[model samples]
Target: MKKIMRSLGLMLALLTLTVVVSACGSKPLSQRNVLKTDQQSKTITWGVKADTRLFGLLDTKDGQIKGFEIDLAKAITKQMLGKDAKAKFIQVTSSTRMPMLKNGNIDAIIATMTNTPERRKQVAFSNTYFYAGQSLLVKKGSSIKNVKDLNRQKGTVLGVVGSDSVENVAKVAPNAKVLQLTDYAQAMTALKSGQGQALTTDNGILYGMSVQNPDYVVTGGTFVSEPYGIAVDKAQTPFRQAVNQSLKELRANGQYQKILHKWFHNVKGFDYEEAARE
Candidate 1:
């Protein structure tokens, strides 16, 4: 009787595991293997970067999120549902974007995430909305002029933990000493303390830091092309199409351009038309 009872317990555990895996595999979307904004019986949560300045930043005093990415997300939410789709925000960093999507913690990720083939395996991406690139941020009047000018053996670089942006730096400077910080704020601190000769990351993020300190600048040509996209779970095909279509409409009606102009165009070195193109 004891042996029989133990076997039954094992069976139950296996069943539970199967159920959990099934839940992780898919999410609610009108299209198979994509996400859609079809029905609105519930509110949708979007994952955004709370620490990155230009892309996503928290207004501590106002208790609001304000940035180019936030504005775009709000516009998408408004277009997908009625004027009142009711959207909530979840703070996500580079490391949290994928796991949160798989677990259904967020319906979509509108952070400055790049659409790469490796990431595509885990989550489906909507049409590319923003065009940013991997660039180097260095102290102004510093000797570092470009990637080719970087002395990997001599310079230390700071990056966010597990970020795709950091991966590009390795390829650009094979021998450069690299350090990973937890978030944008920590990374900036490390840079300011002279822990690293330079900080390498997305151009949009660097733009925010540049705004705060004109002494530091994003220098050199864009080394790696990074196309930003809205991320949905790989199983939510329908929802992905709907969201992409909404973005298309935004571009067709000139709303997309306005958003870019409002936040990015004002930043020096940003091209509104180029960013609008896929």
Candidate 2:
């Protein structure tokens, strides 16, 4: 009788363990969403930049984040989810964006992130949504016509922290000094304050800076190509593929052109049509 009771107790414990393991294994992918979103919720939380002007910026009047990247992310989210899908924006900076995505704080990141091999190790990227190039921003009448001109001892370039521009500028202008700031606003302030002779970043971003400050100009058309892509957590192949499909559909339906034109058409030096090319 004693042996039988012990056997029964052991059997009950084993069964309970199996059931608990199965429950954990069977948890739905939707429940594990980074932003705590799912089909039922019909909402996609996006990590966007509040400081970037054309890419993502907070409008002072309405207090809403608006820009080309914001519009693009919304379009993609709608296409992937449904027409009625809603986007909830969360502001993320260059340094915080990746960590936020990793921590499940945002569903997707679309704030001017460039696709690179190193980034791919941490997060999967959607197809190339936009193409830009590294360029230089300098004060008007400054002699820095191109990146080549910055390859001098007295020249210095400012870039934002967590952006590849600082390392990239070093590769192009080996002799020039490089200073990194927390964000574009700070980088620009540093430039205005004479912390750096020129600001180095994508031409599209440089153009946005120029629009705000007429005293500055974007020179050196393109030193390196920067391809932007939407990012999701690594190993999420299904979600990444869905985003890629949406991008292709957007391009085929001419929606891509409409969005691109709406933002880049007024920029002086950028060629919108060329950028639209695959």
Candidate 3:
């Protein structure tokens, strides 16, 4: 009996030690240094939207995602991690981007994410790389011209889930009913089916949609300023600073302007020049 008790005590002690060691081995994501890891790996994985046109879109032909945000991420990665350092992209939606970053699936988020105070609490943001504003898109002959029109008619507005557009619409047009879809593609589809009077989102994005569907137009211009930023994990201060520095360099070297022109020069109803850094 004495020997069996001693054996049981030893097993419990070993189990406790193992548990303590396992707990110590697992460090929180906030404590990990993403910059150092990226440097060592010679790659930075970016979480980008695969649906937002003009910002990030998956080209069905080549099965590759391309757009202004993808170009910008490539430029910034090259600028920060040497020209040879590679930039990898992982498709993310508005609803998944934050959770992906928090889980360390991607190093940063360069999607068309607005830098609002609420988001700032969850992740660190780089300087405003792009400036956008909220706007409405409607069929060319539609009577809805703006937020006020929606309010007067008490119409339904289409917005993407996990985007600020619906909340903005609610604030600006309290009478308008908002239908939040899973993504821009679905919202656009709902608009075409006459489910909603207007599709609301960033003006840049609306312009992209208009380019593809000539029958639609961005109406009422932009009502709210939405400055876009690159989001990193909340603990990734060094990576965020590095991104900000790269943006500054890109602006000074004229690369930023070139990229903006590449994507927006032909986009109707959008002033690409206004987005240029002075």
Q: Please give, for residues 173-235, the per-residue lDDT of candidate 2 as tens digits.
A: 999988889999999999999998999998888889999999999987898888888989875
Instruction: Compute the lDDT of residue 188 as modeled in candidate 3.
Output: 94
Candidate 3: which stretches are off by over 4 Å? 1-26
- Tens-place lDDT per residue, model 1, 1-278, is 99999999999999999999998666444233322333544356899998988778999999998888888888887777767676678999888887887776788999999999988877789999998888889999888888776763468889998588778888878778889999989999998999998898878888889988788999986899889999987777777787888899999998988888888766888766667778
Q: Evaluated with TM-score, which candidate comes out highest?
A: 3
lDDT of 2 at 153: 49
Per-candidate TM-scores read 0.86, 0.86, 0.90
Error of 1 at 35 (Å): 5.8
Indicate whether candidate 1 or candidate 3 has the larger TM-score. Answer: 3
- Candidate 3 lDDT over 164-230, as tens digits, reads 8889889999999999999999999999999999999998889989998999999997889888999
- Cα error of candidate 1 at position 185, Å: 0.9
Give Cα distance to truth, residue 224, candidate 3, Å. 0.9
Q: Give candidate 3's error at residue 107 in angstroms.
A: 0.7
Q: Rank the models by TM-score, top first.
A: 3, 2, 1
Please list the Cα RMSD from the true structure of every candidate, rounded to 1 decimal place.
Answer: 5.3, 5.4, 3.3
